[model samples]
Target: MLKKELPLKHIKINYDPIIDTPLEIIAQYPDLYEQKIAENGIDTIIYDNDISDNVSFYNITYALNKDCMMFMNLPLEVARFSISNMTDYIIQLLEKSYYVQFLCDPYWVSNYVSYQKEHHEHPMLIYGFDTVNKYFLAQDYFDYKQKTKQLVSFKDIDASYYNSSFSQLPDEYQLLNACVLHCSKIVNTKAKEINCDLIKQSLINFLNCYSYTKVETEGIYYGIQFFDILINRYHNDSDYVSL
Candidate 1:
């Protein structure tokens, strides 16, 4: 009998789940996350005009080992064929103090609204497993729209894993099917300090309807100005803005 689970002190579910797991893992190390989060929190990208535009405070870059915790890519193909027993592979990774995130078909995941109804694909993180109970501790947003952890059967996860089709995703998302989240080893001797100056400047820029980055960039938008941008965008939808 073997049991393994990692500590996740908190979960921030404001963004997509791919980025959520990294933030949840890093939150366990508050000493590292608190100060850094205050410094490099917000990011905005708008490469594609119609889509791919995003504005977020908890960007993945800060959550990765560079800021608080760490994560490494695990190609789903490796887990698919390389391991004779997928459950054992997941348990071994957990035993080593690593959390695993898998992009799976939500239809096979019982808690999801799409469960057993649709084959929509999404990400789920496995933080612990109980061999005795035949379930893995996984995290996801229920229909309630909050971060919730549930005990999922090993068989269901296996089905979800096999049913997922990553090929339909964009090329940039290729091989990004799974992740191994771990903590940093280096000790921080320096005292934690909030970057009040940076935060103040960001607030100023946001209030002024200016880009926080201060440099001129195309398409990328952020801060209070985004509201105006959205208003103007919606206003163009009809002869006049509707509500």
Candidate 2:
């Protein structure tokens, strides 16, 4: 008798009801909710036998827009094991591909860096370099978190305030401003599918206000070059025809 080989099993994911309860509260604020989904997709894969049995995986799939990237959110008990396994798989995939930029919230980097410093055996830390400038620029938010004991709130929380303060920053801060512009551009384009001249104008207004800062001149030049490269690549690539 010939024994047939079984198909490879798909990994199961579970969500934490307690932790995820806050998501419902956050959803009340439509703008905030949309921003959260944009920054961290609603579809988060979990791994728990108990929850997995009750919930329909379809809901998870639906929460995460079909176009967005998927990420596995491991529980604390299995975080290390799951992260190691996932990291290995990611590295293998990256080896086969060209470029892979892990676009994640800065807090993830902080946690991973701190974990590596403590244990001294982090695989991701293999590309460690001085992040002093990045840290220096982010010190205020980090300090606020340390004191208030709250996760860094997204910029949308006080859009006007940030918009004003952002206008005052030096050109060196243009990179950060560009990230915000990019996000705004994505949101406007996705929501309306029309020319976003208004959004672009707003970005330019914000950029213009910081003319006194030396960082502004250099930052604008760099930002334009970076934007052009990104636009050209995305436009030329048949697979990535749209932003």
Please, what is the whole-model Cα lDDT of each candidate in the order they appear?
0.46, 0.24
For model 1, what is the error of residue 227's alpha carbon versus the real structure, in angstroms, after optimal superposition? 19
Query: Alpha-carbon error at 146 in model 2, in Å?
Result: 32
Candidate 1 lDDT over residue span 1-243, tens digit each: 467776554221122222343333223234444544323333321121233222212233323322222233332332232344667777877775555665566677787887777554455667789998889988766563776789988888777655455554355433233222322111122422223344335434534542223335475344444434433443343121010
Candidate 2's residue-wise lDDT over 1-243, tens digit each?
Answer: 111111111212122222222123223334444445333322222222354422211221112222232232322322222222333333332233211122222322343323112211111111111122111011112232331112222231122112223233355432222111100000112222212243234334433433322233322333223324333443344132110
| TM-score, one value per model | 0.46, 0.21
**Looking at candidate 2, what is the lDDT of residue 72?**
27
| C-alpha lDDT of residue 55 in model 2 | 22
Question: Candidate 1: deviation at residue 121, Å?
Answer: 2.6
Residue 71 of candidate 1: its Cα lDDT? 30
